[model samples]
Target: MIHTNTAMKTQYHPISILFHWLVVVLLIAAFVVIELKGQFPKGSEARELTKTIHGFIGQIIFVIMVLRLFARILFGAPEPKNPSQALAMLSKVMHWLLYAILLIAPIFGILYFQYAGKEIHFFGFTWPQLVTPDPVMKKSVENIHELLGNSLYFLIGIHALAALWHHYFLKDDVLTRILPKMKGVRN
Candidate 1:
């Protein structure tokens, strides 16, 4: 059984909201840079530069995800405004899946670079090539990274749609929970 309560209004911590939107922006940048890289011919400097920028963005995302996880633990989220048991369960599963992908995808990207025996240059520093060059392993890890990267599109779309569904169809505060509060605006 479930009941909708319009009076219940709780929002996420301000810091949590910042981190959430920051990650979203970073993810968009990452995708854009990688896609833009394809416009440049292979082996061109512009292509490599975009790839490096994408890597830097990925690294930043990984660090923020770690912080976000800690913030989530320390400052737990508000309960959904009157969700059914099934909706609550589904929300939890979706969130955990998103967290797993955000955390693990970067590691796989790093491993791909390592397996390819390439140094990751970030802001004048270089990451050591931790793994010996193995063409076979490099290709395998690249495939995995690509698969995870592609899955993000589907997962993010569903997440966004679910939030919209809650906001418009269910008339719930689910979307506004993570949105920043504005003056003279009611969430």
Candidate 2:
């Protein structure tokens, strides 16, 4: 007899949850790397290595984001059952902005790398160069990339705070909406 696999009823899609958490972890790691690399003196191989790792992981995030977008479009997601009108609108806007940034930031990063005369390695495969070396262009792209990073941090912070506010102060069903439901809990 063959056993069929069934999806979990209580949890979000395993892959979705995994990707969600992975993105968070990767973002934290990226921030830490960026901070450490900046604070330490430059011109060292360690700094260079850290930068390469950051770029590499960033590329991974780009790919993951693409897959996530596709998954979201194809599979769709359940929205919060009940939320204040303002909170609901904020959620929609924030999600769209998040997607916009996820899609654009990586392209800019890749462009920055190319303009800086660097080849991108994606999991042992090298992506062809997209731009000829130009320090000025590279500098411009780097500045934009940095700006996007800062904006993304603020957006993510707001998202996190909103969730916390719902759980703690608002005392609404907002947090429970997206979270995997507990088996024994009665609504």
Candidate 3:
């Protein structure tokens, strides 16, 4: 049986770890495609193709994130140890913020897609439209959606930096608590 104790164990399930890392990689790829590839000439096939690819990957992340959230509540997360009250609250609030953004960003993106009179397809499977086209609404939604995504990058950066801080400065088990278990460690 996988033990849930924080003092002894240093990680979550292997499956959860797998999903976490996969999402990280996918998020990086999606971000790069959207923000870093804008130097290419307009009307280029490559630019359009990258946008489609980014959209498809974003859709995939949306599905996985919902699954991850469900798993968190169903299985329950490990408890923290002797954390300062403020730090504990910070953790909880930051986590919920991340979850809220993850859920909202994709929905907004899909709404923008429909509003702009485009069909959203996930790996060639057509996703149903959530809203009809309206040029003004489309522009507004798309702009805010893009802004939220940019905001996510900074939030994610803070999360990463916090993890590193716990790992190196505090020398706490916070980082290890989510790391993959070593072969000899009891699960």
Best candidate, lDDT: 1
Q: How close is candidate 2 to the true structure, as a TM-score?
A: 0.83
Query: Which tens-of-lDDT digit does each residue in 1-187 have in candidate 2?
Result: 2112312233345556567667888888887887778865687888877878878778878888887776666555555423577766678788789878876887888888899888888878998986899999999998998899899999999988887887788786555655545589863
Q: Residue pairs in steric clash, candidate 1? A: none
Instruction: Give the Cα-based TM-score of candidate 1 against the true structure.
Output: 0.90
Write out the backbone clash pairs for model 2: none
Of 1 and 3, the candidate ranking higher by lDDT: 1
Which residues of candidate 3, in runs, are more than 4 Å off? Answer: 1-10, 184-187
Q: Tell how far residue 106 is off in model 2, in angstroms.
A: 1.9
**Which has the higher TM-score value, candidate number 1 or candidate number 2?**
1
Using all chains and alpha carbons, the TM-scores for the candidates as numbered come to 0.90, 0.83, 0.86
Q: In model 2, state the lDDT of residue 34.
A: 75
Q: Say which candidate scores most in TM-score.
A: 1
Tell me the lDDT of candidate 2.
0.75
Q: Clashing residue pairs in candidate 3, if any?
A: none
